[model samples]
Target chain A: ARPRVGYFYSGKKPGQDISETMNNMKVGDFQSIPVVVREDVSVYDAISQMFLDDVGTLFVVDKKSFLTGVLSRKDLLRTSLGNQDLSTIPVHIIMTRMPNVTFCFKNEPLIQAAHRLINQQIDALPVVIEQPEGLKVIGRLTKTNITRAFLSLSESHEL
Target chain B: ARPRVGYFYSGKKPGQDISETMNNMKVGDFQSIPVVVREDVSVYDAISQMFLDDVGTLFVVDKKSFLTGVLSRKDLLRTSLGNQDLSTIPVHIIMTRMPNVTFCFKNEPLIQAAHRLINQQIDALPVVIEQPEGLKVIGRLTKTNITRAFLSLSESHEL
Candidate 1:
């Protein structure tokens, strides 16, 4: 006689479809803190920062702290094989400069970013905020984040 | 009186559960070809092989072709910083030796493998088959593969 009010509470989002749930996943929700280095930093120092921070990619910023390039471990490894003095060579010399850098926006769907990572054959993407001067890297979205999102799918459904 | 069989064919699995679908994804279905190197190969050669193959991780095998260790881009980058002769150092010295390496099996569920990738904080895992002699490296599972699987979920449901 109470209109079956209590029976509807199943502790789950009623009729929540998987596709709808996935589409709601945003890059800002899963992105990690981005690591950035000044373009003038040495390759040796950049490598050191990579190890110290334990990240796979580093965004290169200009004197105004605007994104100018990106650096990956693969880039650093390739340069190491050159037998050049790493300490003397600036990261800008080896970095993948703008106009070639692949990036994403935080408010976008995570799936879109995932496609970019796969198609571009890259490890990470700088999540950027468009600015009057240039792109400002706000976060890092990578395969690791995608993997975590994949795991979360199962985890949420398990409940 | 065919019980409306034709109408029921909506091209979707009947009453399919999200968790059930996820658990059905196997590691073998998403694994990539493993790039391996001999334990005796010089660090320089290993690095070269990694670049040629464009893989982030390399499995190290013994003379018997049994899994012995694993090498990551991080490992090689650290070694490069030593300023030592990379060609003179065998990968065995820098590799993350067996018993310390985290691996997976092809038959394992993708969700389980994804958990390992997140918990271990490793880029990739050597998918292996256990033999009487030792583990045989059969494939490689990485974050890239996991990311692909994530994309597939949204794709399959889009219809």
Candidate 2:
């Protein structure tokens, strides 16, 4: 098929304008599978889960499987510096608890989520669904995801 | 100044094409200050430095100040899980050493460096200056920087 290029309006254009294309990019299109752990799980186990999943951030959930908190590698590392026993300490004691966790919705524009990442200085955000009980994590969005989106933008328009 | 838009090329346009603008974003324009630790520094001290600097990755250098290795919080956290004393273990023993390290030059297109970060599955890369002896650590390129660039693109064109 010939590359989609429009004269002025869409008379059957192949590609959207750059701004239009970028603005249309949504978090759901690029989010990754979220790895979650229950609030009572040991910090030691949480760290293990992090490595196994190879994610920088992990979402913490309650017994109802609703969002409760968030854990980062930095958080775990800081706790490790203490002389406390990691296995005996539950992640809830160390996690950045709910009402403090930054989040995004799957339908949110990628640019808005990217701004949250930069301004908040965070590694990842749980892409969540609003539940009667609490937020249910449906996906993970990170700088990595934004970076991928940025690359895709350039790739799509490349000759 | 009115927003520059051209019908084709040259003439009296103000804004260049999206592809041209994206391609022109160089690593040097977006890289962050690199934080380095001597290879011989204790893992304990390195972790402290990471918290102090608030950076995800730390570059390792030799006495001569050339890049030798790189450390991520994951590396340090893994070491912490060990029974051994962190202060006794040197960062050199745990760092991802040279030759295996992925890097980018200052003049490299941001897209190229973003690819290296994703392909290598790393949080950051040392923006380096090559020398006869080894690579000189100059700046740090990370997903965060890429995310910022992505946001900037949207902000620049927003009405």
Candidate 3:
């Protein structure tokens, strides 16, 4: 299913304003270049991508690099545990499809992205940009990125 | 480095209250039983334990079952990428040690525990209780657990 652009949240408390500090901070500032994959790739190749990229998650894209699905270590580990041949199994079979995947825009506030990551219980959020074709994968906001932000804030504040 | 219990956080933009909905929630209500492991276990055994347990993380414990360290796919994957022997390596060498690990008491607000997970870039938070010996891990709050909670809320709200 193609994921709708609607944001999935009710906020920590409904009345809460997006923190001024977070709203000022955008995803582009902290996001890392995403390790993209094609839906046709075998699961074995996806695992290799993870190893080579040193990332726990991968964003599956079409030939256009349009967002299609997402894959994580748990997804690979769970599927690989059985007797099935990873080489024969295509990524689309196990990948979490669009609309089901959580994503953020590059200009969006960091708090919104963090909310999705924590509330949705996903490891990373694919930073996507809208195009005539569809939502195309760009960068990614991961927990590690957020942790680095927190550490930077801590270090700067202590000064 | 040992992390203190101090809540190092600012308000959600100002006039916000800890989501009245989330502040009322407890980890005991949402946590899953943790897959436990021993410190002396070989890396290979730990990986096998992960397969058998069907979990991305394993709680490394001692004979007393008191919590000692935590292991996840990233840890194993990173270590195994090396040419060194996995069968000979002990789990204790790679696990995130206590006092350094972020944990949550069953009675703590789920929101607070979630903050630690996102801020620390960790995949799971051990739901623990304090004993004379140390903190004993009783259950675990994972991103999947949080996703379940969000889904439940979404489904109910829709109905």
Best by lDDT: 1
Give the clashing residue pairs of candidate 2, or none.
A4-A14, B4-B15
For candidate 2, give the DockQ: 0.34
Among these predicted structures, which one has the highest DockQ? 2
Q: What lDDT score is found at residue B152 in candidate 1?
A: 90
Q: Estimate the Cα RMSD of every predicted model relative to the unseen true structure.
A: 6.5, 5.5, 9.8
The CA lDDT at B102 in model 1 is 96
How does model 3 score on DockQ?
Answer: 0.17
lDDT of 2 by residue, A107-136 (tens): 999988888888889999999999887999
lDDT of 3 by residue, B17-106 (tens): 223444566778889999998999988788889878777789989999999999989887666545456778899999999878788888
User: Could you tell me which 10 consecutive residues in candidate 1 chain A have the lowest summed lDDT?
Assistant: A1-10
| C-alpha RMSD of candidate 3 | 9.8
DockQ scores of the candidates:
0.31, 0.34, 0.17
Candidate 1 C-alpha lDDT tens digits along A1-159: 222222232322233456767889999999999999999999999999999999999999999989999999999999999888899999999999998999999999999999999999999999999999899999999899999999988888773
True contacts reproduced, candidate 2 = 0.38
List the candidates' TM-scores in order.
Answer: 0.91, 0.91, 0.60
